[model samples]
Target: MADTLVADLIVERLERWGVDRVFGYSGDGVNALMGALRRAADRIEFVQARHEENAAFMAVGHAKYTGRVGVVTSTQGPGAVHLLNGLYDAKLDGVPVVAIVGQQNTSVLGSAYMQEIDLLGLVKDVAAQFAQQVSTAEQLPMVLDRAFRAALATGSPAVVIVPHDVQQQPAPEPAQEHGVVTTAPEWRRSQVLPFDADLQAAADVLDAGERVALLVGQGARHARDEVIAVAERLGAGIATSLLGKPFVDESLPFVVGTMGHLGTTASAHLLGHCDTLLIVGSNDPWTEFYPPPGAARAVQIDLDGRNVGNRYPIEVGLVGDAAATLAALLPRLRERTDRGWRDDVERHVRDWHALVEIRALTPADPVNPERVVWELNRRLPADAQVAVDVGSCVYWYARQLQLPAGVPAHLSGTLASMGCSVPYGIAAKLHRPDRPLVALTGDGAMQMTGLAELVTVARMWPRWSDPRFVVCVLHNGDLAEVSWEQREMEGDPRFADSQDLPAFPYAAYADLLGLRGIRVDDPERLGAAWDAALTADRPVVLEVLTDPAVPLLPPFPAGAAKLEQMRTGLQQEGAAGRHAAELLETYAAQEGAGR
Candidate 1:
């Protein structure tokens, strides 16, 4: 009989925890682990990502889409270090992930061996819940148990560092005694209802104010029905943080879009007019975007007690799951009348939508990026999952993309990492092969990480029967976000030498790799290009030559200082100054008039 190796035991335990696949790159340091994976090929699949960073991101994206613990592996040193960014993305977003990295052989413990670094030291801060290196075969099962448990409990990244030699040793034999490793039941928790007193206090706060508004985030995604019920009971207008876009139906009369710099004008109006704010399952960092400190009395509910009132000062803080809390609290609340605030906000939303349509339909020489995103939004399938990159694309998505209530999107929420969209889309496609997958990235972001992962998509495309994947590149030939930021913040002309990127033929590059490539340089060809990419026979790359001069400003108002700063910068710009200045002034003036 073959002795169970330490690597084999690790794979066995992962399968027990319901992990069927892992994303990683093979290396000499993890040779034994790779060999064990090969042996368990039928039960578990190994996805080869080009860069170790992309491997980690794929794991994060898989976790996001499936709501499971994402897993990724890498070799020692640089491979281990490369996992930090994606791990931190998981950490900051409060998603569960487990990272397994190989280490130098046990024999080279004290010596500064080649490709040997302190793996734990590099990852401890980011992998918040658990980070440890296994020293012996006996420690393997128990440590893996603890790591998985901690990730499940806290929704944070966990790390396990196994030395090369340690992975090749014999596994600890199964014992009759039960523990976390062998006989621990699934880590499922019973529903916890909020206390009567806390519920009453929250009800009292809601009852006192006539104009109540709701602020939601990703935590409220599963509790949408309960949230809408509470809103109906209180006549509350709903607004979301960027991550909470899936929490409510955007088409609802009083349901304002996201609330932040990327938020809608309607959301701003709703948040400002409310005398009471009900924050559910979100820790919104932008304090100014919410009601003023003394203006609104606040009540908050969250699954984690520590997050209660963390983002805003609250009169009543109820610590329970969003659905449970809302369900309990709704019974005690009195139904309120519209009081005309809802109508006002709804009108604002309608006007905002009209403005957005006008801007989207307005034709330019090169394709308008806003129009491209708006077109995609209209054409996207209901079940599709989109992974949007950072930079100027954030403005278009946050402003123009009307995400349906049930459709899920993967954005670099808090971290706002640039190159996540392509890899995230690949992961989404791998998880849900039937659904349409789209990766929206700026040219710079695509150049950074999206281009490298094309080969990965090409490799995996043949395996799935219906692999509908599209990588939409907004090739604006510059980092438009940074350029706008430089002008708005520093009152300086965009430093062309630093911010400008050469015009790269991304569509041709895709064609060279034997994928369907569609390029749209004119607005007339834009509609067909999107249709072609969406219904292509193989994975497609749709590259659009968008205008670089478009301002990436949000619908929300900029303060006086920001407006003046942007004006000064625009004045310094050569011939393109007046149009940009007028856009800023027009929005700023409208904001003042509304207030």
Candidate 2:
């Protein structure tokens, strides 16, 4: 038998590590690695993405949804550079991801040869724990092992740069076979129970407060029941950071929606009035949205001690798993009566729902964008995985998509990148092939990077019988959020000239790719379109022509400068001006009533 190639060892190690699929685009530098992947197809699958960025995002989504280390490979220079945006998303979210980058021959180390770049230097800051270039084939196994170790231990991206020449070298043997090497990698999970003193201190902080509010992040996703139990015992109202949406049961009486710029008014109100804010597994970076600095004494619980009080001032910081910490803290605390706090929170939640319903159900000349999300959410499977892009579409989704507990959703969050949803949907479906997956994106966002990904979706799952994935395109003709931002932040008149985009016939585009397409222009037909897409036998694109004039009102109160800027912009505009004025008045009334 021919000696095993170094490339074979790379693929073998990945298989041994339990990586089932690799998302990436093929290129010259990775030619050897790609060939080895094909030979090892039974052991691991290679998911070809349209762009390296999408590959990176798919890996991020896979990691985020599966709690596994997502892996992606890219070619030299540009391909590796394109992976940054998606890698940064993983970085901010603190998820485990491994990026395998193919580099030019080592012979041109500093010659600036075609596609030759310093891959390690490029990813060091973002990859966090591991970013190394492999020079010798003999060193490959140990370096690859270290890469996986760093990713699994830190829950951060690890990058291994393998040059083309290095991959073609002869592989060394004597390494034990996969089954024989039975020892699992060593990685420390957060302490289940905190030290007795730390637990007591956390309990005392909670006991001293008359009113407490609970906020959760993605860290608490696996501990939903524990979070709810603690909230109920403390008579605390619960809110989620956008990423923490899956943690709270939307059906709960005291549960408010997400908290931040893309949050609910009820959540804003809940935070403002609380005497103690107990944050669990969240570092909600928005300082402005946080309740006034001194208004509430705060306590934070997180597995990583570094995240404690990272976003806000805290009186007590308990480092441990959310479930375990809360479990230990619960026994030491005194149960409090509701004292009308829950009732107040409930009323705000109800009012916010009323507002959303009114907007969602209202008919418009061009369909209201909110109606599309509402219909999609209603038609979606209870356990569907959702990926929402950042923009005007997010406003509709954040407020309208009442995600059921246990349903997973991916958002760009801190990075706030557009064109992420479709790629996210692709990876989500690949991870949970049997479950329904949906991608929600705006016209601008879809056009940016998602439209090209439709081809990949169509080709990825040709054998699946049911429509495994749905892409909902809210096709308004402008970068609606950017236009709104110009009006709201810069006092610019609503100008469609710069923001307007050609309305691509997305449904037709889908049909051409051997996928089902449904276009809904009328709000009355929106539900039917959603139903058709949901049941289609293949991937479906449901394009809804949305009204661009509708204002996406901020859930929280705006400062005087922003309010004045919006008013000035409205006055300078025409029909949109009148619409903006009405939206402002309606929101002002709702805010006053809720308070």
Scored by TM-score, the top model is 1
The C-alpha stretches of model 1 lying farther than 4 A from their native spots are 176-185, 363-365, 559-561, 576-579, 582-595
The residue pairs found clashing in candidate 1 are none
lDDT of 2 at 78: 97
Q: For model 2, what is the error of residue 273's alpha carbon versus the real structure, in angstroms, after optimal superposition?
A: 0.6
Worst 10 residues of 2 by lDDT: 179-188
RMSD values, in order shown: 2.1, 2.9
The residue-by-residue lDDT of candidate 2 on 49-72, one tens digit each, is 999999999999999889889999
Q: Considering summed lDDT, which 10 consecutive residues are worst modelled in model 1?
A: 176-185
CA shift of 455, model 1, Å: 0.9
> Which digits, one per residue and each the tens of the lDDT, describe model 1 over residues 1-595?
1487999988988998899989999887889999999999999999999999999899989888889989999999899989988999898888889998899899997799999888888886997579999998877887888888888788889999999999999887666554424544256755767889989999999999878899998888679999999998887889988888866788887788888776777888788789999999888787778888889999998887889889887999888888988999999999877557667767877877876776677555487888899898789888888898988887788778887767889877888888999889988888888888888899999888988999888788887667778889999888989988899879898788878888788889889888888888888777888888888888899999987766655555535546767777888986766765665665565555544
Query: What is the TM-score of each predicted model, taking all chains together?
Result: 0.96, 0.95
Off by over 4 Å in 2: 174-192, 495-497, 559-561, 574-576, 590-595
lDDT accuracy of residue 71 in candidate 1: 93
Query: What's the C-alpha lDDT at position 227 in model 2?
Result: 92
